[model samples]
Target: MPYVSMSALLAFVLVYGLGLGPIPFFIASEMFEVAPRPAGMAWGSLANWGGNFLVGMGFPTMRNVIGPYSFLLFSAFTMGLFLFTKFYFPETRGKTPTQVAQLCSRGLRSRPLTTATAKHIL
Candidate 1:
């Protein structure tokens, strides 16, 4: 197989293999406490579909504007977003539902975790 095809295949495998299923699970698990159960699930599903639709529908335009590496550019942006969220977003694992909601409403500064402090916890 050609290098491009192999690279593409590898990218697909890496994305779907590791990323496809885990993100929603992680987000849902975390957000469930911050939002009501029903709202959390609804928002999670909406965000998932919205993001997928936006990326799929915008691909052609993105490609045209950004050229052949549009997917790579998107991936980079996504990675940055994920990292930013991971570092800045609070970990709600053991917190009560009310506490989580309060944290969300008030942002990280009002709670225990912030980007600067996340490194210590994680």
Candidate 2:
């Protein structure tokens, strides 16, 4: 690839990866009914870092094992996970703790909160 093309590819990957990567954990926190507390936040952060570390630590071996096409598979899996979350995860905002817990536990789909839901909850 040309220099400009390479730069564009790099930028695209950076933006795309950063934008969609954290979503799984954001959904997980809701799905798991993690309380909005310091400890909960700490646990979430720990989980995120742990995953990051595991991937980073294994990247070289994975790259060698899978070759250049590994990233394509990785991206595909990431997008699949995102789509799965979008379809299955319940929105948690504006819900009481009990409601959130129930939604998470029962897998009951709640419509995502709008301004009206925010107003009602507030």
Candidate 3:
């Protein structure tokens, strides 16, 4: 297997640090109602920490077994998420929480899965 250089690792970390790391927290906070926002944020934080722990614990074994190809698993998952968000996620800009929720519900119910109603989330 080919060795991945430190530059590639740095690039991944940089990209994640720039956008992926902070944006989810903002999005999670924006996504919930005032009444449930605290609980939602807590759950989101838990999931984030849990996922981090899983990767921290499992990455060594996965890397040892799969070598550089271990990165491919994450790349594929990230790509899927990108596509899902691009298509299914809504535009919440300038909207109230209730409006956002209603928009999401309408999109889910009336629109075809293949069609993206939201202009862009990213």
For candidate 3, what is the lDDT?
Answer: 0.75
On residues 31-91, what C-alpha lDDT tens digit does candidate 3 reach at each position?
A: 7778878887888788777877898899999999999899898889879977777556787
Off by over 4 Å in 3: 1-15, 104-122
Clash pairs, candidate 1, are: none
Worst 10 residues of 2 by lDDT: 29-38
Tell me each candidate's TM-score.
Answer: 0.61, 0.56, 0.70
Best by TM-score: 3
Give a tens-digit lDDT track for model 2, residues 1-122.
59999999799769857885565456555544445545565676777778778878988998999998878877887888755655567767887766767777775454676798667756
Model 1 C-alpha RMSD vs. true structure (Å) is 4.8
Whole-model lDDT values for every prediction: 0.71, 0.70, 0.75
Q: Which regions in candidate 1 have their CA more than 4 angstroms from the true location?
A: 1-14, 17-22, 93-99, 110-122
Model 1 worst lDDT run, 10 consecutive residues:
26-35
lDDT of 1 at 66: 84
